[model samples]
Target: MLIPQYLFDAEAFLAFRIIEEKFHVISKSRISLLKLQLLHERALHRGHLKVAQQACDELGALASPVTGVDADLKTEVSLRHARTLLAANQFSQKSGNAALGLPYALASILFCQSFNLDLLKASATLTLAELWLSHGPSEAERALALLHGVFPMILGHGGLELCARAHITEAKCHLSDPSYSVHHKPDLVLSPLKEACEQLELLEYHELAAEAFYLMAMVYDKLGNLEEREKAAASFKEHTLALRNPQESVDDILNMI
Candidate 1:
């Protein structure tokens, strides 16, 4: 069945249903990988963890036979699988299993290293750092070190959205740093967050931008900057509403400001 790309980009429920109905037929073809990847990304973007997981599982199955597949293809699959695993783990709140994502992350990192895929290596590194970040402040040190190492790669070779993600991760690392509270330094966190929001807004990554704005509001509140906090909070609300109502016009969202 030839499915239109826009069908996969349609409303989440409809997309999920269409994909599920055609999955068995589609999985037999060479285009399956691309289709599954697109589904995984769209599902993840729409916060449909189960649908993403379904796509990831099929991707994992396709990549299971390691003998004849192209090295780069395998590595890309590994990275996406790791990302999906991490997202699922985060959404499930499977307590005491914080390291549930560790092996998948390590596999992706190792695949990147072995294949000498530098840009992908940087992404895999970021995923590892994110996993470490979830382990708390003690692990934030390790995560920060990795984030620092990848920033150059992400900024120099990665796309704008990836660069924005790196900035957001860096800000999160700082926020999670115990020293941040002790030193009462909001600027270190705020600067990167501001940059991240700019990039995210430019890309129209509304949900992620909403998250960045929410963080900014918290940071401003901590620093006793009520005016800035109010602005950030307003932006957060605007972006959040935009995310919920994806059909909302840019002018409508801007009018909320």
Candidate 2:
């Protein structure tokens, strides 16, 4: 289960083999659950979606027959499966498959709502909004409608990372809205994008932060503010490099300024 420390393919494969061997011999349900969780996470990290899905399916089967704390685990696992599918759909090469994650997102939202899991509900809502936004201008209004309540929901129960994503999604909806864009008001997106970038930086999610900065740079360029554009562009580059070399000190990035 010490897979995170040594994520090399060979090590991961060996660990998986060992885990599978132990799983068959293990009698404790909790121990088996932990092993499955580790396999699920490691497979997802390695982009082995089929393996992750199988792990998730096994987790559901293991958790479904239990109650009390295990019931909570079941719900959490369900949500996680939904999230993994959503991520896969979002990153898919087929833009035409934007609806791929919709059913899972909706199901997760319903599952969370039934349990009164407000935080997970909000998170699932955000995921649904993102999926809608991915449909381009045709679904922008629907995305905005969902986003209108998402910020307040995230603020109330969600953590900084979710809040950052909410801000970014809100900004994306505005950017994609024909009514908003046709007015030539690209600056309207800058505020939320800036908030997203700040929150992502604070969370040390440099890859996503870089994307937010790149969007801000584009907005600044649209506003004809070359200086602000350059600044945002520089930040984007710095964050991008930080993601590639995480061990590099802050001073290393600062020196590029």
Clashes of each: 0, 0
- CA lDDT, every model vs. true structure: 0.73, 0.70
Candidate 2 residue-wise lDDT, 36-56, digit = tens: 676665454434566667777
For model 1, which pairs clash?
none
Superposition TM-score, candidate 1 onto the true structure = 0.79
What is residue 103's positional error in candidate 1, in angstroms? Answer: 0.6
Candidate 1 deviant stretches above 4 angstroms: 1-30, 92-98, 181-184, 245-257
lDDT of 1: 0.73
TM-score of 2: 0.70
